[model samples]
Target: MEQEKMNLKLDMDVQKLETKKLRKGKHKAEEDLKSLKTDYKKLRLSMRTVGLGKTLEQWCQEIQEEKIKVGRWERKFQAAQMQNRSLENSLSESQNERDELKARVAELEKTVHQYRNRNSVVELKASFGRIEQMKRTVEELEMALQNCEAKIEYLEANDDHQSEQLHYFQDQVTKRDHIMGEAVV
Candidate 1:
């Protein structure tokens, strides 16, 4: 962006220099034409009285042609000045556009940064919720496993008590049979 501004300034400076050079050349041409006209009038008077084609006449004709060419250059210079003005206007417009684009880019960057910050916050919140939910589920599962283990312990104790009762009844029946056999003898 800085480079673009520098380039624009350089372009303006060069354009100004070109315009100044053209104006200076136009002024010089006008002065040369005035000088030529004065010399031509004097030379024509001398040629008329002397009755001869002098080197001065040829030089005067060349000066007249130079004056006509100078007029054309002056007109061309005016056209160039107009073009320079148009270019300056265009450059200014382009600079404005560049500034606006920079502002838009900055705004977009800010928006993206804000969105990322918000998204990260949301993700953290979701992760925390999930972790808390998992902790609760783990605790519930542990309690259920403890309850199942307690039931298994109770069932094992009941089975042992029932087996001991069955053994006691069998011993009593065997003793009664022995007593009855002795009485019969």
Candidate 2:
């Protein structure tokens, strides 16, 4: 009975040592699970940060491109403004030239009208002078014709009287010749 009691006490001590070892192993496994969970969370946070950084870079690049386009458009606008100003100046010069030409044309028209009026007055005066000369010539020709008619009438009357005297002389001569011839016979 003494040997059996000693063996029973040794068995009890071995059971206590096994219980302590089991508890230590369980605590180690729980610590390992927690470390794995922490590592997963860190990985998720790093992935999100990398994705946001790429998005920000893309936005910055778009903004830079837009700025470049705006600069190019501004230069084009300035050039167009300069061209418009030059065209306006050219238009003004053309208008001034047109106005001057109009004034010159009006002056020339006025001069032409004055010359036409003077020419008409000179022609009227010349026509009046010609009419007066024609009247004087007609009067002189009529008086000369009357003098010639009077001289012709006088010459015809004198010739008729001379012819009557010549016929009387010839009859007297013929009667004398007849009386002489009778005496001779």
lDDT of 2 by residue, 88-181 (tens): 5555555565556556555655655665677876755555555455445445544544554454445445445545554565475557545544
TM-score of 2: 0.33
Ten residues in a row with the worst lDDT in model 2?
Answer: 150-159
What are the lDDT scores of the predictions, listed in order? Answer: 0.63, 0.60
Task: Give the TM-score of each candidate.
Answer: 0.33, 0.33
Q: List RMSD in Å for every model shown.
A: 57.0, 60.0
- What's model 1's overall lDDT? 0.63
Q: Candidate 1, residues 1-185: lDDT per residue as tens digits?
A: 99999999999999999999999999999999999999999988776554344377765875687567556655655555555555555555555655565565556556556656778777556555655565555455555545545554554455455445545644664576456445533
Worst window of 10 by summed lDDT in candidate 1: 176-185
